[model samples]
Target: MDSLSLIELFLSALRFAAPLILAAVAGLYSERSGVIQIALEGFMLFGAFVGATSAHILGDGVAGLFMASGFGMIVGMFYGVLVLKLKADQIVAGTAINMLAWGGIPVVSKMLFDVTSNTPALEASERLPNWVPIVVALTVVAVTYVLIQKTSFGLWLTVAGEKPEALRAAGVSPAGVRWIALMISGGVAALGGALLSISLASSYTRNMTAGRGFMALAALILGKWKPIPACIACLLFGVCEVAQLKLQGVMIPGFGVVPVQLVQILPYAITMFLLAGVVGESRAPAKLGQS
Candidate 1:
């Protein structure tokens, strides 16, 4: 490819990777704090729906983004409460949250806008600043890295995940740390979701995340739960998606046109392959998934 083509490809990769970066960083926080972050998908979905709907209602995309973040945190709080207070299994609770978002968004959309599947499309001017989401996502990755490596909270988070009793001996509540981590995770993941509707696409579609949440989870694991490495992993996955989009239709000698559907599976397929091959070598927190 030409230099310009390479630049274009790189830009597209960044665009596609933005949401994954956000979600993966969010997962990093929750998982590093000893919480299984399976509910990222639900968090993203809720964010997308709430962001789009709020933007339409308020006529301000930035406001919508904040709204999305707030609501996402609420959902996160709900999830945290269930797991921390009620002692629900984290994975099961997370799965239920995902299912609830998948079904509940449509119901709310239909009631509010008379459309059961998607929110009304936002005008270009009504969407958030185009470069904002990507910048925010990258910033989140940086902030997460700093928070994990440079600060006291980072130590708390590490202890919460690997040695909760240590944190308790330090006079901190592991449960409190985890609850805050999950809330932050929800807010960050929600921004990724908002980007999907307000920056990348013009409207919210049912299940518009299309398993990007799961892909982000894979990236998190592949990066061994570090902020910078996870961001790098997300960028790699984004490149695969961009390739899928760019290679939509082409003829190969004697093979006919390339199947677009197969191309669409590229990122997901790569994610699964990496997870199966690499995750065994990645070390998770010793106390991860412990209540």
Candidate 2:
């Protein structure tokens, strides 16, 4: 490839990976606090819808970004209530939330925009600059690393996941720590969603996130739940996605011309390999789902 082509590819990779980076960090915070957060997809989907709608209405991309994070916290708190207060199964609650996002978002879109499709197309004035997501993702990673490695709350977060009784003895409520973690996680992941709608694309389309949220979760596991490594993994996945796009019509010796649909599976297939322990084994926190 020419230098210009290589630069374009690099930028495309960054755009693809940025949202996953934030989502993986979101998982890091919640899972580290002993709460499993499979509802990340739902939270992100909601954020995308809200972000697009708000940006279109206000004609201000920054305002939409803030509103997206705010609503995401609300959804996170709702998930907390289900799995924490009501003792719902974490996996079940998460699945329900994902389904809820898929079905409910379109309904809301219909009511607000009179279309069971996506929100209205955003004008240039309503869209964020492409570089915005790349910067936001890196900044979030840096802040999260500092908070997790250099703070008292980080200690409580560790204790909550490893030994809740110990945290209780220290007079710090493990549940409280998890609640704060989940809320922060929801907001951060919502920013990822907002980035997808406002920065990566012009507006929110139904299922616009595709499987990026779950892919982010996979990246988290591949990185063994660490922040910087997880972001790196997200970027790697992004590179593969861009490669797939570029390879869509290329000829393969045995495979012939690559089908677009087939090429798109590269990222998800990698996710499955990671999940199946093909990449390596990963251990979760001891009390990950314990209330």
Candidate 3:
């Protein structure tokens, strides 16, 4: 490929990585606060629907993004109540949230747009520029780094995850810290989905996230719950996705013509492969998943 082609590819990689970065960071706060973050996929799907609907009605992409965050916070609060107050199993609660997104969206869409599948096509004006997501992704990463490394609250978060009893002795309510973390996780994760529908695709479609939420979770594990390292992992995954896209229908020297289906599976396969290798060695927070 030429230099320009390489530049374009790099830019594309950044674009694709943007949402994954946000989602990973979202998981970062949740898991770091001792919550298992399986609800990310559901949160993203909810955000995508809310964002697409808000953008379509309001005709402003930025406004739509904010709306999605708001809804995401609500979803987070709901999740928090289930797990924290009701003492529901975190993984099962998260799965229920995902199922809610899958079933509830079509009903809402039908009521609003008379379409049970997707929202109307968005105009160019409603879509965000490619650079916006990259900037957003990096800014979130920097902010997360500072929050995790520099703030008193960040320390509280770490303690809450690693030792809730210690946090209690420090006179901080671990549940309170976790509440804030879950809210942030929902909001940021929703931004990931909002970007997908409003910036990348211009409208919401059913199941549009396509497991990027889970991919972000893997990135978080690979990063061992650190902001900068997690961001790097997300970028690497983004590059893999871009490579898969670029290699579709291409002939290899010895492999002959690879099937498009096989090429499509490459990124996901890489995710599972990397996770299998790394997760066993990576240490999680001490108090993670405790009810």
Candidate 4:
């Protein structure tokens, strides 16, 4: 590829990876605090629907983005209450949240827009600019890196997740820390969803996230829950997606056209290999999910 083509390819990869980066960063917050947040998919869906609908109605993408983050926080807090306070099964609660958000968005969309699949297309101003996702991804990575590695909150989070009793002895509430982490996770996930709908696509389609949430989870594992490394993993996966889209027609002399499915499978395959010890074992919080 020429220089221009390479630059274009990198941009496309960044765009595709934006949502995964956001979601992975969010997952980092939750898992680092001892909560297994499998409900990231649901949170992203909720954000996408809310952001798209708000933008369609108000014709202001910024407003929609803010509204989506607010709603995501509410939902995240709810999840925190259920899992942290009520002591519900984290996995089950997360799955339910995903189902509820996924099913609810379409139902609401159909009722409001007279369509079961998607809302109306947004105007240019009502959709996020191309650069928004890149900015958000960078911001999340930077903030998370500092928060986990350079702050007292980070120490508290690590201690809470590794030894809650010790945290309690030190007058910190482990449950509270986990709750805050989950809420942050939810907000970031929602931001990812907003990026998907407003920045990447003008309308919200059913299952638009299409397993990106799981991919983010894989990134979290591959990155070993560290912000910078996790961000790299997200970018790597995003590059795979971009390659799949751009390499569709470029013919290789001997290899011929690469199968689209194979390209699609690359990120997951990489995830598996990383998890299988090629990258060393991932060390989660010792007290994660323990009462």
Pairs in steric clash, model 4: none
In candidate 4, where is summed lDDT lowest over 10 consecutive residues? 274-283
Badly placed stretches (over 4 Å) of model 2 are 1-8, 253-255, 278-280
Q: Tens digits of per-residue lDDT for model 4 on 1-291?
A: 699988878887888899999999889888888888899999999989998999889889988888888888888999998898899999899999999988898899889999989989998878888888998888879988888788989988888878889989999898888888888889889989988999899988999998888788888888888888888888898888876777777788999987777777776787778767645667777877774
Against the true structure, whose lDDT is highest? 3
lDDT of 2 at 243: 91
Better of 2 and 3 by TM-score: 3
Model 3 is weakest, by summed lDDT over 10 consecutive residues, at 272-281
> Compared with the true structure, what per-residue lDDT tens digits does model 3 show for residues 120-209?
988899989889899999999999999989999999999999989988998999999999999999999999999999998889999999
- Prediction 3 global C-alpha lDDT: 0.93
lDDT of 2 by residue, 1-291 (tens): 799988988888988899899999998888999888898899899889999999999999999999999999998888899988999999899889899999999999999999977999999999999889989999999998888889999889888998999999999999999999989989999999999999899999999998888889889988888899899999999899889877989998997998998888888888887788744578888898886
Q: Give me candidate 1's TM-score against the actual structure.
A: 0.97
Please give the RMSD to the true structure for each candidate, in Å.
1.0, 1.5, 1.2, 1.8
What candidate 3 gets wrong by more than 4 Å, as runs, is 1-4
Using Cα atoms with residue i matched to residue i, what is each candidate's TM-score against the true structure?
0.97, 0.96, 0.97, 0.94
The full ranking of all candidates by TM-score, starting with the best, is: 1, 3, 2, 4
Candidate number that wins on lDDT, 3 or 4:
3
